[model samples]
Structure formats: structure tokens, C-alpha cells
Target: MKLTVLGYLGGYPSHGGGTSSYLLESNGFKLLIDFGSGALLSLEKVTDPLTIDAMILTHYHNDHIADVGVMQYYWQLHAERPKEAVLPIYGHREDIQHFDSLEWSGATQKVAYKPEEKLNLGPYQITFMKTHHPVTAYALRILEIKTGKILVFTADSAYFDGLIDICQDADLLITDTNFFANKVGQKWHMTTFETGRLASQANVKRLLLSHLPEIADQDRLVQETIQALNKPIQVQTAKTRLAIEI
Candidate 1:
């Protein structure tokens, strides 16, 4: 399986940056994780929108779901045929309004899932775990059944022990490190320090930082996180076209 960073920022994009969105593809099957602000622009550059097999949402924040409407528009206007246009969207029941609204528009179909249920999408096996966030949020664990490789994504969350267990030795961990350590509070997101600490404890092979806020110097933030880590771990700032193998 391969992971691609389509958009990496949160809240709103940083200066011209995009909000939370990612694309994953394996064995000719494609899936979109989140379609946030600026996602459509970035997506159009990478691949045909119609090729997306399905989409999933971790939460209902506008920063996360902002592009869902436009995606529907793309299908409605550009689809070569009508029957293949509806993209299946999997979101929790907690965000009933977002699902209902999209389903009613005929742009996407609502697929229901529960915590800890393993969903089979071709060779990809996905599982969800509820996370600590202001709204209903979930963390994803997607495993390629044939390769036995797993990728974990903490869509958005505050510091919590459950995240540590969910990330255990994952091939790659995508985390929301939205603020600097000293400046962050646990009300919504985790600081980069806690982000690094989780990677250290979970023994993740690589750490990909996402949901970033504007910083004067990104390298400084990287250094700060490295210092707090118990052991050296590979760290990369999420960026468009950046791809990782699972």
C-alpha cells in the first residue's frame, strides 16, 4: 500500500497551504481519507477524481469536510456516466447531518461503521477507534490483508493513552501536531512534543506530522520534537506528492 499527502494543514490552510486530506492506493484500488479545504485543487493535479473508489471521514469539522460538496459537483458535472458517479462515504453516525446532507444530494452514499468493526474493502482491512476530541472523532487502522502492513491515522485528537496502543509499531503514523509544545492545550489537539512522545512509546517506524499551523521556522519545530523523543525516529512533514510505502 502507498500513502500520499494531498493536503496537510488544519483549521484553515497556512498561507496557501491546504487542510487535512490524504489519498491511499494499493493494488489498483484507491481511497481518500479526508477532503478538507484546498483538497480539490491538490487532488485534480494528482489523479482523476472519478478514480476514487471511496472516501472516509474522521470527523465533521469544516476543515475536514469542506470539499465534500465540490467533490459531488465534480461527479455531477464531469462523470462520463451516471451510474459510476456516486462515491461511497463512510462516516460515523455521530455526524448524521453531514452524511444525510451528502446522501440526499446524490453525490455520495452513506456507509455506517462502528467502533472496532473491521471493514473489508477489497484487500484493505480498516478499523476505527473513537478518539478524545470535542466532536465525535476516530483514528483509523488500515491493513493490507495480503502484505500484513498497517498504517494508522489519528485524524484529530487530544493527548490520550488509547492512541499509544492504537499506534503500536505501526509502519507509519499520521498525527495531528497542530501546535508547538509550550503553546498547546489538551482541549483539542496534541502538541509536537506529545506527538513525538507517542511515536517513541508506540515504536512507530515513521512519523508523518499533519494538521500543521503556520510556523516561522518549520525546522525548529522538527528539532524540538526530535529532542523530546526517547529514540531517533524518522520524521517527515506532510506535503503534497509525498508518498510512503506501507
Candidate 2:
């Protein structure tokens, strides 16, 4: 399984970056995890937008789904689009208005994913866990069926005990590290220290700090996470176009 960082900055994009978006591929099947601000332009640098097999969203937050409208426009008007192409956009049904927007004419289809059920899409088997966020966001655990590799993404959340179990033994854990270590008692996103604690307790092989703060010194965020870790583990900050194989 291969994972590519299309965009990683949290909240609003800055410094030529975009907010939370990733591409996961296995056996030529491309699965787009989110379509945040600036994501379409970044995605074009790697592959054709029309080539994306499917898309999934963790919640309806603007930073997470900002480019979804533009993506629909691309599928609707792109000259090279296939005649019968319809992209399946998987999203939770908690927000009916945003979920309805997932479908755009014949270009896209809205598919509701229940947190209680497991979903099989192409080469991956996915399970969802509701996250501790202001909105009804979900964390995803994707398992590559053929390779037995697991990739977990904590879309957006505050630290919660359940997360440790959901993320346990993952080959890669992409966490929502939207705040620095000093910021605490917030409910929207995880801090650098909290992220490191989760990764260490879960015993994930590798940790990728994503959904990053735009203005903070990114290197310091990584260093803080490393210092907070209970044991040694591979840690890296998410950057556009950064690709990793699991």
C-alpha cells in the first residue's frame, strides 16, 4: 500500500499549502481521502483528477471538504472525462446538507458510510470510529487486503481513550496534530504531545503528524512529539507530495 500527502496544513491553507488531504493507492486503485483547499491543484501535480477511483470524507468541516465543490466542477466539465464516469464519495450521514452536496449531477454519487459497519472498497477494507471532535467526524482504519498492511487516519479529533485501541498496531498512523504541545484543554484537534502519546500507546510502526498548524515552526512540532514519545518510533511531519510505502 502507498500513501501520498496531497495537503496537510490545518484550518486554512498558508505558505503555499493546503488543508488535510491524502491519496491512498493499492494495485492501481486510487482512493482520495479528502479534498481540502488547494488540494485539486496539488493533486493535478501527481495524477489526473479523473483517475481517482473514489473519495471519502471524515466530516463536513470546510478545511476538510473545501475543494469538494471544485472537484465536482472538474468531473462535470473536464474534456477528457469518461462518458459514464461517476465518482463515489463516501461520507457520514450526520450532516444531511453536506452529505447531499456530495452528489453532483451525474458526475458524483453520495454514499453514506455508517461508523458501525465495515466497508469494502476496491483493494481495501475499512472500519470507522467516531472521533472526539466538535462535528461528527470519524477516524478510519484501512487495511490492504492483499498485503495485510493497515493505515489509520485520525481525521480530526481531541485525545480520547478509544483512539488508542482503534489505532493499535497500525503500520502508519496519520494523526491530527493541529496544535503545539503547549495548547491544551481544546476539543477540536490534538496537540503534538497528545499525538505522540497516542502513537506510543498504540504501538504503531510509523507516525505522521498531519492536519498541521500553518504558522508554527513545523520542525519544532516534530521535535516535541519525539520528546513526548514513550518509546522510539519513526516520526515525520506531513508535507505535500510526500509519499510512503507500507
Candidate 3:
């Protein structure tokens, strides 16, 4: 399986390097993890969002779902004719409602699925678990049934103790890390320290820190996380075009 980091930040309007979306593909099958406010622009730097096979959302924050309307426009204008355009969308029920309420005009016609239950998209089998957030949210686990490669994506949420159930033995775990150790224990979002500790405890093979707070330095934050972790797992800061094969 091939995984591409299309974007890897939370609050973007980023003046620097970090972006806010992620794309995963294997055997011609494309799956998008999150499409933040700037993701469409960032996505254009990598691949055409109009051609993606499916999209999954972990939450409904503006930074996360802001591109849905734009994506619909892309497919409607730039892509092939009507019969050739189809994309599957999976998200928490509330997320579905929020997007639906946007009444994105022609966009509603493209809904393939609303994640009524555990479902399959392209090469991946998916399972959505609840997460702690102001809005109802989900932590997504995608496993390639044929290869048994598993990847987990946590959208935006505070560190919850029961996270192990969603992340055990994952090949790659992409988590939200929006603060430092001293600033953890907030009502929302996780710090680098908390993420490293959870990844270590989950025993996932690899950890990718993402969704940095606007004030955090990417290099320093990751370095601190690496030192605090002190584990054998592969840990790295996520970036654009960075690909992981599982």
C-alpha cells in the first residue's frame, strides 16, 4: 500500500511549511483522510482531488471539511462527464449532517455513502470509533484486507485513555499533536508528549505526529516527542509528499 502525506497540520493559514490533508493510495485505489481548509490548494500540489476515489473525514472542524464544496466544484467542472464522476464519502453521523446542511447545491448528488455501518472503500476495510471532541468525532482504522496492513487516523480530539482499542499494532498511526508536554491536559487536542506516550503504549509499529499547534516549532516539537517516547517504534513528523508503503 502507498500512503501520501498530502497535508499534515491542523489550523492552517500556515505561513510556513505544514499543510492540512492526507492521501493514501495503493494499486490505483485512492483514499483521502482529511480535506482541511487549505487541503484543496495543497492537494493541487500533489494530485488532482477531482480524480480521488473516496474521502473519509475524522471530524467536522472548518479546518477539516472546508474543501468539500470546492471539491464538488472541481469534479463538476474539471473532470469528465456526469456518468464518469463518483466518489464515496465516509464520516461520523454528525459530520454527515453538518456537510449536508451546507446544501452545497449540486454537491449533494455525489454522496455515495454516509457510513451507516462498517464499510469497505477501494482496497481498505474501515472501522470508525468514537472520539472525544466538542463535535461528535471519529478515529478511523483502515486495513488492507489482502495485505493485512493497518493504518489509523485520529482527526481532532483530546487524548482519551481508551485509544488503544482503535490503534493496537497499527502499521502507521497519524495522530493530532497540537501542544507540548507542559501544555497538555486541556479540554481539547493532545500534546506531543501525550501522543508519544499513547503510541508507545499502543505498540504501533510507526507513529507520525501531525496537527501541530500554530505556535509550535515543527522540528523542536518532534525532537521532544522522540526523546520523551524512548521506544523502538518509528516516529517522525509528517510532511507533504512523504509516502509510506505498508
Off by over 4 Å in 3: 16-19, 82-84, 101-116
TM-score of each: 0.95, 0.98, 0.89
Model 1 lowest lDDT segment of ten: 98-107
Mind giving the per-residue lDDT tens digits that candidate 1 earns over 83-178? 646788888887677767557345678887776688897679988888888899999988889898989999899989889988898899999988
User: Which residue runs does candidate 1 get wrong by more than 4 Å?
Assistant: 82-85, 104-106, 184-186
Candidate 3, after superposition: displacement of residue 131 in Å? 0.7
Candidate 1 backbone collisions, by pair: none
Candidate 3's residue-wise lDDT over 1-246, tens digit each? 888877777776466444457888878888888777667777788776666888877777877777877776776676354654556666555555675643444443424334446677788888877788888778888898889999988778899888878888899998888787788344488888878888888889998888877666778877777776757877788776788887
Q: lDDT of model 1 at residue 181?
A: 79
Error of 3 at 26 (Å): 1.5
Best by TM-score: 2
Lowest lDDT 10-mer window, candidate 2?
179-188
Off by over 4 Å in 2: none
Which structure is stronger by lDDT: 2 or 3?
2
Clashes of 3: 1
Q: Candidate 2 lDDT, tens digit per residue, 1-39?
A: 999999999889997999989999999999999889999
Give the whole-model CA lDDT for all candidates, comma-separated. Answer: 0.85, 0.93, 0.75
